[model samples]
Target: MIFETERLIVREWRDTPDDLDRVFEIYRHDEVTRWIGMEEPLKSPDEARTVMTRWQARYEKNEHKYGPWAMEIKASGIVAGTVLLGPLPEPSDGSEGRGEIEVGWHLHPDSWGHGYATEAARGALELAFGRYEVPEVYAVAYPTNERSIAVMQRLGMSPRGLTTRWYGREAQCYVTLPRQRAASN
Candidate 1:
């Protein structure tokens, strides 16, 4: 496992049939996919497998320092969804790299309203600030994504307003420092 919270185990995605099926189950929903990526739900098992392959490649390329990881419930051993800790894509405009890291989550709709996103994200922040010693972490979401915004607030991230920097489209940004996290606790 990459890390553990009181109720979740964050770990690497496996290549098993069950894992692939779980990946499909989570991403096939439009409700879950609307706020992330291309805003398109995976339409088939093949597409889900392809996505899993791409994520696995990213995991290998980053040497596990960063990637979208599987969030497994400790009680049922059910894979809920993904929590990502990675370098945000560079701004669309010409600029030097800022080495900005981001923390974000995407969970199945069934996992909603259960505090799992916040718990898993707290653990991801702990990994970022404690083991990785990253000075700061940011989260960006569509301006209308109130659920994610709420999670950011709960984690003590301060709003930085909107920007087209990372994903080449305007996104509401929030950032947090190690010190801010301590104060929030």
Candidate 2:
């Protein structure tokens, strides 16, 4: 599941052979773990390694089929962050037939505002539409996260409604209609 965008590579998962310290380095980065939810941000590289290990196991089981993809920047070849897609059974409120896949992204804070989120997201959108036969894509973000909301807007997506149950709090729900609009443009 390696998808190459114009400037990034979205892959399933990879276990780098970096040193012990480096394994924790990305974890210890506050900016990197900001949007991630945990009782506390990652405290050390070991902790991050454990989390990534779990991700690896999940991918081994093909659990990520409807979830996130690792976002790697082509220029740096470094794993910057990840883009998430939602259609999973857990969080979904039985909305599979709704014709949409919830989209999300989390870039290291350093990668913020660099178009990486949008680029990687576009790739996910392409996959969702092209491969999944998904008729539409959607996203939900805290209303205050102006950047994510902006990226959704830039993707030609618009809000269908707002809901508080999404992330355990209110969020703006954005949606992109069927692909027919692509031809209208």
Q: Which numbered prediction scores highest in TM-score against the true structure?
A: 1
- Runs off by more than 4 Å, candidate 1: none
- lDDT of candidate 1 over 88-184, digit per residue (tens): 8777756666989999999989899999999999999999999999999999999999999999999999999997787767789999999999999
Clash pairs, candidate 2, are 24-45
Candidate 2 stretches with Cα past 4 Å from truth are 19-36, 60-64, 88-100, 180-185
Residue 99 in candidate 1, Cα distance off native in Å: 1.4
> When superposed on Cα atoms, how far off is each prediction in RMSD?
1.0, 3.4
Candidate 2: tens digits of C-alpha lDDT, residues 49-81:
687777777666755675466777889877677
For candidate 2, the lDDT comes to: 0.68
| Cα error, candidate 1, residue 96 (Å) | 2.8
